[model samples]
Target chain A: MQRMADYISVDDGLVDCEVYSAAVYERELESVFGRSWLFLGHEGQLVRRGDYVTTWMGETPVIVLRSMDDVVRAYLNTCATRQVTLLPYDAGHAEVIVCPAHRLGHDTTGSPVSGQAVEPGHECLVPVARVETYGKLIFGCLSDDSPTLRESLGDATWYLDNYLLRENIGGLQLVPGVQRYTMPGNWKLLAENFAGDDYHVAITHASVLAVRAQGIEPRLNNSPGKGVGANLSVATGFQTGVPHGFLEVRIGEEFFEHDLMRAQSIGPEAAEWVRTRRDAVDQNLPDLAVKPYSFHVANLFPTLSIIGNGTSMEAVGLLVWHPRGPHQTSVTQLCLVDAGAPPALQRQMVWALTHQQSAAGVFAPDDHENFERLAENTRTFEARRVPFNYEMGLSGEGVDVRPPEWQDPRWPGLVLPRFTEMIQRDFYRYWRSLMDR
Target chain B: MVDMELTAAATAFLNEEAALLDDHLLDGWLGLLCNDVRYVMPSTAIMPAEAADARERRNALRWGSFGDDDRDMHFWLYDEDYSSLNMRVRRLDTGMAHAELPESMTNHVVSNVIAGQDPLDSELIRVRSKFMVHVVRHENNENTFVGSRWDKLRRTDDGLRLAWRYIELAHPVLPRTISIFF
Candidate 1:
């Protein structure tokens, strides 16, 4: 490797096409994303028995809907001839999914309803592979050999359940749709950024956090965003900090003051939601050492990440890693929410979840400006070391999360100074692993 | 008063408006509107068939005809005053509104104008046109924008001053940002 002093080069590209020629993105499309149990959607998406929504698994388009039998299903959304775009809209419910091109159609359960144009032989939106549902969570694949969704998640399901899934939990609902934002950088840059990088708050998101109000009438200096203002309680010290992938920050008590009981929808039942969310955050979250648990962001590799505490619906972001060229990547995120709720509650969740997390979100955008500038401007003519240092929490305190997400279970969260460089390091580490696969 | 001449004037008025938009002259674009003019884009929902029928009767399609295109909350040269428009212009100048950036360049190709008389005055005119817009930014490639536009023109010696403008964008998901004037 070159010295850290040298700047980044196109040669420092994300994919080493030569070394990993066999494990190309094409292979990833056919293998990784196709069979990795990509999240298709949640149960709330279809409030009615026969409603449906559609999404993608890598490049494979899939439809998800609640069948007339009340079962949620996932199926290859492509036409039998593979000549259709499926449903283009991000999310919508249809009694039956119809294709305009081949006149192919299917019921919510992936069964042929009509439009095949073929005889009674082969028909419908060809059931490409496995379709699985974990409560409201739905996933699909295009490969018959793909493992079940539970197998793909591996031991990580424990983390998912402990952190998410709760009773009266609103069933981990995805808000009606999502707030979309695109990040221009290396696709890995964003994936790793969300995977774990709490050290960035001191600089990248300093202003946004400095101005964040505790769900109250945040007193901006008579201005929307001035560093210091009347309403902001500035004197308190933040948390110490944690290692890579683990983050914690303090949130004030003056939060979760929603008058949902007066909302008339859940009304008295709203207390169950409050308890479920608060309990989940308090029990499951680990310390980030420096950043406190009051605020936290945890990402479970490759694509999915959540930004949340207990009460607030953490933005569940799905990354669309689109390679722009040899190095440029456009990472698009669709923040999820509970779709079963009424529109009034759903809207608030979308912005708050993403407003705190998306690439353009107050915090994420600041980080974006930094990474984009880093990636776009670093394509120099000469070789230079663009070493991203994660030495801060190394040994002195809050180093790296041991083993990192279920890959190894016994690792501890501490590193020597300039300690954990998990994301960038593991990215290359996994890159090599996939190449050999 | 509402003749082909009025149609000619409305075209020029729209042309100037487009020029201002291209030039990042937001206040100038808002200046050519009537205060009571409405500017709204209603939400699109695929409700049940029963509600869908009622919505059609209410013209609840993307832009509620009366609420968004005809409501009194719309701004113009007189009502918003220069300050309100200036504030809007400032909003564009600042890095606040992520929806659209003043830096984005645009082209509005307006044609197929349909003109009629204003009910309040025979001397006034209401004109509608179908437009195809093309926008380009440094980072993104050119994107086509399809929308229909309506304008109420009150003749001034300078030609015709705009009284109202209602733009109905055909593609609601919008390529990027729809910040410029149409």
Candidate 2:
């Protein structure tokens, strides 16, 4: 069988189609997902004792809950006796999870409640190796040796903190009800897209950009220019050795100015709130603040992806691309708003997110279509011989190292010009490193 | 006994709306909506019976606690007002909406129609119906969406028009992109 080295060449910027093969996919489940810190859900979801949300760590279903002790915990959502799934629901308040197969009950902390005769540790719900939280976001890792959540996040936190720990605005609170859907593609496809594929945005989302340019839906409009080249030039990509990647478009004070001008329409209080928040950001991270009101898409390696706009009106959507197989991916998207914002502003942010990024949203379909086609194309024998090119910025045309003037001491990553595949290349390099282990 | 005439009229209106959608005559479909139209599709969840009941109780207590009556904290596939709906139709008209560039051939089946006079408004009729939409795009790319809709139809000057529609898709996890309106 071809090894990880055969499937990807980071230096060559070429990825073999066989990377999507079943063998590679199965290996990644253990090598990459098993060892990586995967995002589970936000702490905001499990506010009260007994509150629980069911999600997948890779393909393994786990239940994240606030136990009776008020400590957040996660356990394999399966009965130890027959390995039957204990909880079938997406989320709920459950004091004890009972297996439908045999009526065996387990407490929220994965302790057996009904099984008395079974051997100790044999009949209890299996617990994940580690469950940790970065701010309000909860993450789980299957391997005990995996780095701490903060360590795994690395310099990526510099960007994440901009939203996850924004100033003046309260911490992020996940909106209820995750938007779950299945996509026809390998999980990596979606991950890489969010990692840094700003180039595709102008072309893939041309229609939406065109419509937004006309200013028909002013609240949802983020496009600054009509031409594809003009739109592509505004954003830049950032990558870290931690394998995290993100794209950002710097909108500068234009966003605050727009918010102030349209204050009467969005309501004066909400407008004033925006002004205060922007000022807080400027005070906190003066260098990074200029880029606050921009579109951002980032992937915290392996699965979790975030698409957020820094504007008060736009929401940050956290997406998990759970691998279903070599070809299928199950996506769970949760919308988040600043907890400090007024209820009305939060609602508008949610609405704006729903309008642009949800299942039926204007932008997601085109990306899904492309991913589906890529999945199909890469499955054939002929396609396996042809390597997918990732060499766009390799020759240094239209790509530049982070200029000294643009550097912020706080932001620590290999920041590159927008229209390059360097971020995707770094993503594969890290994936290859994991697969090599 | 069911009001057969009202049911027939409601069914006809739904069928007409379905026809316009299936035909990709989005503009014509938009014409069927009242100026204050509210089209919504809430994301569904699978929960234990007891857990669902508990959530309902919690929601009941928390309903008006937020000051604003915005109980729509849950994510939705769509929560469109008339203006947003108009913009959606206008998006498709742009011919660059690649998801539907090679527009999907759709068949919208509307059934289980039940209509009654609204308790609060004599000029409005509350209607409940089931819908199965089969969509085939790019030959092999196909998906079927089956759901139920609770709609409020008002007797407007332009005839009975959809004022509010709440869609509940049966699938907790949607199969694929929902490019077409239900």
Candidate 3:
């Protein structure tokens, strides 16, 4: 079996194809997913007592629920007795979970509640080691020794607050149902893409951008530094020591310029909402507000990815790339909007997410195709012999450094130019470190 | 009672529409829709069958569902109006919608058609049918989508034009990208 060093060389910025092999994948399920904090679902999904949503922590199915005490908790979804699934539904309100096999019942706390006396530990659902919430988003970890969720998130929270906990506007609320679909690829590929792969945007989504460009007026295009090409010149990617990373495109004055164009196309209300939200941000997170950057794509460690497009206030999507096997990933996508936003604005937000991020959307399908092809190509022995390149912005690699004036003293973590693979390299370095233990 | 003539007409219209999509003649397919066409496919979820009555009762008061598609407040796979639908077609025409660049060969099978004249409107018919869309892309990448569809067809000088459509895909988790229409 290949060692972690053989699979990934952070210094050389080369990744062996064997990183996606079954052996490596199995180890990742343990070292990476098992010990790390994994996103379950948002608190908005659990509005009332007994409300629960079923999701996966790695491959283990877990139920995240609001208990009778109004505290949020999670437990393995499998029945203690027969090992059958406790709840088969995606989400529902249940006072007591009854195992379909043999009429055993479990209370909201996952303790067996059937009339028959049960063994204390043998008949209770296994609880996850720790459950924590950052803003409204909930995460669970299987290892008791793992760092707290806040520590795992590290400096990434500074950027996430701009979107997750917007000022005065109550936190984000997910649209009713999740858009779940399967894509052919290793889960890491999708996570890395969101981490800091803005380079692919100009090429991978050329067709969608073309269609959008035709719809926008030429006047809107006058905003200096409007598109990806211009934004890349000022884009910044951050690598938190915890391995979490995000890419931010600071399109200075063009921050809310799209709203002006949208106002003409979609009534004045569009521009009004942007103004109100901008005021809230300015009043609350003055530091983040001052930074003239709105577009953000971040992968919080393993599978959770958050994307916020401040230009289109309604375009926020929370994605989970759940690993299915060595070659397949199941994605659960949720559209999030400010809970305090008007119904019309919320609807528009959902529309934006459905139009661009969902499986059938104009943008995601193209990315899915590329991921599927990558999975296929890397499956063969001959293909596995070749190494994938990740040296685009390696230090001293002749890549232009961001101008000194562009750097923000307030931003934490190792910030690099937008067109760099530093985040991906650091992400793999952290993964390799964890596996080495 | 089922209107046999209306059922035949609706079946023929649906079959022809499917044929146009299968042939990748998206523009021809677009021509069969009314000016204010609403083509929608709502995401589905799995729930306990025993909770059906409680869920339905709750759905009556609130216009959304956590375990099923709620037209008003839930997420949808596709919630396109005429303009959006037209834009999607235009996107494919660009020859760069990579998901369909080497477009898939599709076979749309429409069955179990049931149609009846709308009681309130003389020139409108409500129709329901089951559909199985089999698609094969690249070499061996195959995906089959099975679902039921509800449509409101309006009588026009040209023939029956689809005014509204609601699709309920059976799978709770879709197997692949829905690059092709249902």
Candidate 4:
């Protein structure tokens, strides 16, 4: 069973280790996701003890809670006897999390506070499989074998420091409110697409192209920001593997470039402001050789992906659901970075995103219909030989920029190949090694 | 606590305004409003009790006519002329070209029609009306939005214009950008 011969073939898809395959979506009671060091909420999100927010940790639904001591904690989402989630309310601070149906009561730390109809102690925020954080991003795991959140992120922390963390960067915060939508497709497809894909921009996001044409997209795009050099343009090519062209943090009149530096050198304050944060981030992303890009649209693995436009105004999260066995996927986009940015920046981000590719954007309707039909087409036959063309940058991009681990090279763009036959090749390489053992 | 004739007039006036929005008739809607029609859609924010008391339940987040000329750039609406209104209407047809699906299909229902009996201004009627608006939009899917509107109306020789209107939402954070007027 440890061999993982039964389910995954990263070459086919992420080779599902039998351990994980058995749990892909096993029932809530049995799934290991609930037990893994799942993502709860960010530390910045819960500043006070009573503050609490609910999040699903794989199959183990749970909540990251806060209490009187001002320390944050985790609690089981399930009621004592009933199967329903206990703290269903959106977000609020409170002394106790009580499930009305089961009458199970526990304090924020998930310990028995009181009020369980039982003869005695059944209260406690069932301990998480694990809990940890990198900068502001928090993770909770339910399984014993899965590594700590830091390890779970493995090497992604380096990319995060620039976007988050205050030490050397602009203060980062998530503007509240979620944007959501449902599409019909496999959840994994969306993740791969977000992880790294610049080929789709000209084709799929034609509407965004139109927006850029209309003078909305500030950074010059359709090509690599710096063409191929940070010396030529460090702050220039701060590219994110946007499904479309590139994600450049557009503040006003355009200042910083993709490499997280000023396009033109700056005053002591602005220069220090830009370089320190950029250096901190570069230190984290060990693979980039030098400054890796600052555009932080990340795949929190599994299903969630977010990208910070890195501009004060631009930040959004896409929570995509592509349930297996179903021919559809749900893509929810929440503009979570607007916790009171400057009025102008807010207007620009709101205008550019909402007006272009969002659910109602000119481009979304097209993409939605395309993805829907594509999913339906896949169902027509088994092993239909669905060919994804990741060949766009492949012609010249194959050279190893970083070698052994990656080929990003002096290349100006594309984070890494996340999916596709090529990415599948990378996946199988990793999965096969794991299974071979 | 107002008179009936003025109430009837205000109701008709509000209905006319809705027709304009429903029809995407930006010009007609603007023409019907006061030149100084204070159009501001301020999102509600949760604040500390002390802050709330200082403002007397009134805030910049609260949309109204500006009601004050010194602070009012009230003349901009008409000063722009029908060309501006045309631009707005065309922008809507552009389907949120200015804001992309920014405007939801809101059913602005103004009721509880009340008009003042005492005439303060020559032709102006102190009218108050209660309103409820429902907006539905299809983003990745379908979203239903609901809210209430408070309007203070003043009658003109031609018709009633919204001197001020305040929208209070049951949900403070709007789902997304609402480009269309309610």
Candidate 5:
């Protein structure tokens, strides 16, 4: 196995293909994902007592549940003795966790309540390191030494809360089952793509935009910004704030107005709600300076991504790039709606997400196919010899731009223009630090 | 009574549609749909055998607790009206759709075609067929989609046109994507 040092160079933007190597992947399973605060599931998934949902912490099976005592807890889903998976379903409610094999039963708190030939105080399921929440989002850490979720999120919280926490609404709640599918790609590729990889959209998603344009002729006139080029020119002056590497691209007033038209189609009440929220944001958070074609493909470190739509108000739900192997990733897509959003708005949000981001959706298909090809190409001997270019909009040494005055004091991180490659650079450096540690 | 002649005609129509899709004749396939056709493929979900009841599944979907959306304005794999289908067909036909940049080689094998008069509309015939769509791309990547389709065909003065179609994918987790239609 190669040392972690061979994986990347922060100076020249040289990232070794070892990042997708099985050896490096093994090390990451221990050093990276093992210690990081990983997104588990939202609190809405386990609202009622005895509610539980099954998920993964890297390759380890985990169960996140709302206990009979009304507290949220997570535990390794394997039975202690034979290591059999305790939870058979992805999600369900049960008074007691039971292992189908050998008939070992555990209480909601993961304590061994019933089992034959067992020692005293022996639990069938091992509890995870920590279970914490930021608003309704639940996250778990496998190692106790990992920083708290808020601390781990750091300055990115400001941008996260902007769409997560609404004034009139409480927080975003995940809508039903998460859309999941596997694709041939490294998990990190997904992380990099989502976290400020806007450059690929115009090319990778050209067909989708073209298709959408054909759907309605007026859409051509209703471009998100003056155009991509104009938006980048304006964003360059905005400057990068800190090295948090989080990005938020906001749309112009016309985008919201277009959404307002869609909301009006839903109903009058929904239209009023959209109008009120739009006006409130415009008046209250004037410093944000909502621009045309603004959207955020914000990544929270290792795996979780929060995608904010340019046209809509709330952030698109969580997108988890769960690594099954070096070349395999299982994607989990969740849709979140504002708690206070009317049913009509909720429906609209869900439909919008389904059409745009879901597995069968137009946009996601474009990305996944490309990622699959990337994984194939990168693994080849010829491609690994040369480093991929991340030099766009960066100085000779790859530092992002400074933050604008309006966002200076409030937002933190290596604030850069929306179109810069600095955000992805910061992500890789952060990843290297974690792996090295 | 099961009319053999009508059944033969319905089977021929279904085969013709499949051939159109395989030949990348999207416009030809689209032409078979009536003006107000509704093509829907509900998002598939993996639920425990106990939660397999239609009512229970619908309830979970309604509450946004389990599965994908119920056939409301909720999440769906494909919930297209006529105009939407037009857009989809138009997009696929365009050379720019990167997903189908070089269209995947497809062979749509259809069988078990059962046709009968529609109970709701006398002019409409209900047809059910099982299909297995084998799609190969780049000579290396390939997938087989096994599903059943329920289509409503209305007898027009010229010919029969598909008024409604509901495709049910058997697998809870699709192999990769349902990028191409079922």
Candidate 6:
């Protein structure tokens, strides 16, 4: 295996395909996933004491739980000594975590208790190095040396604030469960797609957009039709403009009124709450203002992404691109709503999530087909030789000139014009930096 | 109580529906539904079995087993009403639903069909059946989905029309894309 120095061959804006290779996948399991802050679960999943959910921190399975004191903690789902996986299912609230392997049991804090022939102070379940949160989104890191979640997130938090920490809808609550599915694809392909691949929307997902043009917006009707468009032209981020990009879907003033009516039909209070919060954010954060009907989609570093319908900030659509193997990815989705929102509205959010995102969603199939084919084609010897071009808006007439305002010290990271590959390029650069370390 | 004749008729209708799906006759299948028809498949989640409360919560989110309450809280794979189903069919008609580029060859195997009078509405009949869909895409990639369906059939002038259906998949993680109806 080549060291980090020769791992990538940058030819202009093209980078070597070794980043998606099987061997490098293993190294990433070590260098990237192992030492990076990974999204574990949302805090709302653990409202009650003993509420826990099993997730992957890299390839290693870990159980994150809220303790009796309400402090969240994470521990490897395997028995410390036997290494036998303790939990088999996704999530739940349990009084004690008992390993069926040896009858070993541990409290929420990973302290060993009564178990078959287990001695005290001999260790219980192995604890994950760190557990942290940002806007009710819980994250875990396996390596102690990893940066703090806030530090790692950096400018990405700015985008999260627009959706997650909006004034009235500050705390987003993940609904009770998750929707998970797998695809025959490399994980990075999906990650890059979420990061900033606006160019593929018109071509790769043309059919999805074509279906949306049929006119039955699912957000308004609670149906299976497309609700959002993919005309992603302008966006903002802390680095580039906030860490948020807008999908260029123009719903005229009449449609916006119709959308408001539909939102009221779902839940008047929730609709009013979202409207007030959205207006406040738009008014307060002038730089972060986006078009009313434009979808807000942003990827937070490694894999956690939030995509929403431009209508309201009520539903928080979360997707985690989990690396199962070199050739397979497990995509998990969670749609969250405010805890205080009406149950009917929460259900509507969940319903809207199904219509728009998720593995079984209308939009997902479009992106999945691309990622699956991209993964398959890249594995070929011929495809590996050709570098993937990300040279758009790099220079000349189409260069993404950085606006003068983003140069202010208030905005973090390198800023560039919207619709450029800068965000994705920055993604890889951060990835390369992590892998190199 | 439903007589064997009613059961036989329901079984035949299901069989014909399966054949229409296999033949990719979406319009024909759509024609069998009433205006208020709801075709839904609930999203499946894996809950820790060791925790009974968790399991109960998860199951509560899921569609109750056949004959239980029809109301469900879990997100759906396809919670399509008539208009949505119509839109979906129209999408396929456009021949632009790229996921079906080389249109998949599918076989819908339906079994364990039981028919009875609806407890709440005598005019509607309740039919419970299990289905296994064998989908072959690109002549190589094959996927099998096993699930149970509860259908509320209402007698219409045209014949017994499907009023509502709840398809609950037994698997937690589904095959890549469910681009076609079950």
- For each candidate, what is the lDDT? 0.47, 0.78, 0.77, 0.46, 0.70, 0.68
What are the per-model C-alpha RMSD values against the true structure?
Answer: 9.1, 3.3, 3.6, 8.6, 4.2, 4.4
Better of 1 and 5 by TM-score: 5
Which model is ahead, 3 or 4, in terms of lDDT? 3
Please, what are the lDDT tens digits per residue for candidate 2 over residues A21-44?
A: 888999999999899999999988
Q: Quick one: best TM-score, which candidate?
A: 2
Residue-level lDDT of model 6, residues A275-323, one tens digit each, is: 6655665665666323333344667667777776444523667888889
Deviating ranges (above 4 Å) for candidate 5: A215-223, A227-248, A265-267, A279-294, A313-315, A396-407, B1-7, B50-73
Model 2 vs. true fold: TM: 0.93
- TM-score ranking, best first: 2, 3, 5, 6, 4, 1
Quality class of the docking in candidate 2, CAPRI style: medium
Question: Which 10-residue window of candidate 3 chain A scores lowest in summed lDDT?
Answer: A216-225
- Runs in model 6 with CA error above 4 Å? A4-11, A116-121, A217-271, A282-295, A338-348, A396-418, B1-3, B48-72
Q: What is the DockQ of each candidate?
A: 0.12, 0.75, 0.59, 0.10, 0.48, 0.49
Q: Per-residue lDDT tens digits of candidate 4, residues A1-65?
A: 23444444433433332222223334322332333344566665677778876655543456776
lDDT (C-alpha) at residue B85 in model 1 = 36
lDDT of each residue in A163-261, candidate 5, tens digit only: 444534456666765667777788988887777687788788877677766655222222344443223211211123212334445435566676677
Model 3 global lDDT (CA atoms, 0 to 1): 0.77
What tens-digit string does per-residue lDDT give for candidate 3 at A310-426?
455455788898999989999888877777666665666677667777878888889988987788889898987788889877874424354566466665455457778877887
Candidate 3 — which residues are off by over 4 angstroms?
A216-240, A264-269, A285-290, A396-408, B50-71
Residue A406 CA displacement from its true place in model 3, Å: 4.9
**TM-score, candidate number 4:** 0.63
Per-residue lDDT of model 1, residues A1-437, tens digit only: 22211222112323222222222445555434654556666666678887766655655566677778887776666666765767766566677778888667777666677753566647756664666766556666566774566655544454455434543345454433333334445555665565545556555644444344221212111112222211110000011111123233233333333322323343433444444455555544453322111324444444555555333333354444444432444443454543334444343344354344543234554554565445544445231233344343223222332223323322122221111334334434443443344
Candidate closer to the true structure by TM-score (higher is better), 2 or 6: 2
TM-score of each candidate structure, all chains considered together = 0.62, 0.93, 0.92, 0.63, 0.89, 0.87
